[model samples]
Target: MVNLSVATFGGGCFWCIEAVVQHLKGIEALKSGFSGGFIKNPPYREVCTGRTGHAEVIQVSFNPDIISYHDLILIFMTSHDPTTLNRQGGDKGTQYRSIILYHDDTQKEIAEQVFEEVTSLYEDPLVTELKPFEVFYNAEEDHQNYFNNNQDTPYCEIVIDPKIQKLKKMYADKLA
Candidate 1:
C-alpha cells in the first residue's frame, strides 16, 4: 500500500475546501479544522470571532502516488480566489484567509513554485500565505461532512454548489 501524506490548507471556510478536496482520487480522508492560530484547541465559535488568528483549514490525507503534491496545490490555487486576502465570497475575516500550511521544507518549496507559476493567472498579486505547518485542531463534529449532510441548505446550495460543479469540470480526471 502507498504511504499517505498530509496537506493542510486554509482558503476560506473549511467546509468549502473539504467539499472540493474530498472528491479527489488519492485523498484518503479530509478533516475540517483550525490552524495557524495562537490559541490552543480553539472552538468553532472562537475562531469565527477572528481573534484567534486561526484560519478555517482542511487537513487532507492522500496518497502521493495517485495525486502529486504539486497537482494538489495547483488544484487548491485554482479552486479558491488566492488573489483575495482574508476572505472568500461573503466570508470575510482572518479565519477565511487563503493559506497553505506546509508540512516540510520540500512542501514549502513546492508551494512557492506553484504560487509563482499561478501568480500571472490573476490580475492582482496572489496573497495566499505559505507557512510552516503547526498544530491542527479539528473542527466540531457538527461541521464535519457539512456539505454532504446539509446539501439542501441555502448556504450549501448557494455557496458550495458552484464550486463542486467547477471542480467536476476542471478536474474530471482526478475525481474518485
Candidate 2:
C-alpha cells in the first residue's frame, strides 16, 4: 500500500491550483472543495456569498516520500499571492482567500516553517491562514477538474491558463 500525505488549501479558484498541482509528481489525488467555515457541507453558492464562512479549497493527497511537505508548502505559497487577504487576482471575497487547512501537527509545523522561510525572501508577510482541518465539502460537479473540461471558457483562458503556464515555467523540474 502506498503511504500518502494530505494537505488542504484555499487559494483563489481551485481550478488554478488543481491544474498546476496535478502536474506535480507524487500527487495521488486532488479534489476541489470548501472548508474553514462555520457551516457544514457548504454549497458553492453559499460560500460565494462569504457568509457561510467557507473558502474554496483543494484537498491534495500526495506521497511524502516522493515529494516532501516542504516542497508542497512551497508550491502552495508560490501558486497564489499570499500577501492578499480574502482574495487572489480578480477573484475577491473570503471564498477566494488564501488558507492552509493542515491535516495534522506535522503539516502545521511544515506550513509555519515554510511561511517563515517564504516571508523572509519577500517584503510582504504571508497572509495565508493556517487553520485546522474540519471538513471538506466537495465542490459542485461542474467545478471538478474545471480547466480540463472548460478550457475554452473566458475565465479559463484569461485566468487559469496564465497561472498554469507560470507554474509550468516555475516548477518545470517538478512537473509530472
Candidate 3:
C-alpha cells in the first residue's frame, strides 16, 4: 500500500499554487482551500475580505517515497514571492499572504530548514508564515482546478502561466 502525506500552504492565490503543484508527480490529491482563519467553514467571499483572518491555501496529499516533503516545501517557497508581505503581484490583502501550515513537527522542521536554505535567494527577509496545520475549508467547486478548466481566462494566462513555466524549468524531473 502506498502511504500518502499531506502538505498545506498558501503562497498567494490557491489557484496559482494548485496549478503549479498539480504538475508534480506523486501528488495523490489536491484541493484549493483556506486556512489559518478565525472562523469555521469560511466561504470564499468571507475569506476574500481578509476580515476572516484566512489565507488562500492548497492542501496536497502525496507519496513521499516519490516526491519528498522537503521538495514540496522548497517548491512552495520558490514558486511565489515569500518575501512580500500579504501580497503576490496585483493581488493584495492578508488572504494573499504567503504561509505554510505544517501537518506535524517533521514537516515544520523541514520547512524551517528549507526556509533557511532559501533565505539567500531573495534580497528581502522571507515573510512566509509557518504554522501548525489546523483546518482547511475547501474553496468553492468553481475555484478548484481553476487553471486547468479556465486556461483561456486572462488571469490564468497572465498570473498562473508564468508559475507553471517556472515549475517546468525548475522541477522538470519532479513532473508527472
Candidate 4:
C-alpha cells in the first residue's frame, strides 16, 4: 500500500478549506467534518449551535513524500484568518475557530513550528488552537463536496472562490 499521512485543520468553514486543499498534489482524500468537539457524533445543526464545541474542519489524507506536513500546515495557516478568536469573515461562533488537530508528536511539533513561522505574516496574534487529534465526525453527505457542486451559489462565489484563487496564486507549484 502507498504510505500516507493525515492532517486535520479547522479554519472557519470546512467547505472553504476543502475547496482549496483538494487541488493540491498528493491529496488522497478530503472529508468535511466536525472536530475538536465534545460530542461523539455531532450532526451539522448541533455543531452549528456552537455549544457542541465542535469546529467545522476538513480531514486531509496526503502523501507526505509529495507534500510535507509542514507545507500543508503552512498553507492552511496562510489561507485563513487565524488571528480571529472565533470566526472567519462573518461566520462567527466557537465552531468557526481556527485550529490544527495534530495526529502525532511529529505532526504537533511541525505544526507548532509552522505556527511560529506564519505568526509574523499577520498583524494580530494567531489564535489558532494546536491540539491533539481525537475524533472526526464526518459531515452529512450533502456537505461533502459543497463548493464543487454549488459553485454557482453566492456563498461559493463570494467566500470559497476567493480562497481557491488565493491558493492558486500563492501555491502554484503545489497544485495537483
TM-score for each model: 0.98, 0.95, 0.99, 0.98
Of candidates 2 and 1, the better by lDDT: 1
lDDT of 2 at 24: 91
RMSD of 1: 0.7
What order do candidates take by lDDT, descending?
3, 1, 4, 2
* Candidate 2 lDDT by residue in tens digits, 17-69: 88878889999999998998899888888888999888898999999988888
* Candidate 3 segments whose C-alpha is farther than 4 A from its true place: none
Report lDDT per candidate: 0.95, 0.88, 0.95, 0.94
Badly placed stretches (over 4 Å) of model 1 are none
Select the stronger candidate by lDDT from 2 and 4: 4
Tell me which of candidates 1 and 3 scores higher on lDDT.
Answer: 3
lDDT of 1 by residue, 1-176 (tens): 67999999989998999999988999998899999989999999999999999999999999999999999999999999999999999999999999999999999999999999998899999999999998999999999999999999999999999999999999999999
* Most accurate candidate by lDDT: 3
**Angstrom error at residue 151, model 2:** 1.0
Clashes of 4: 0
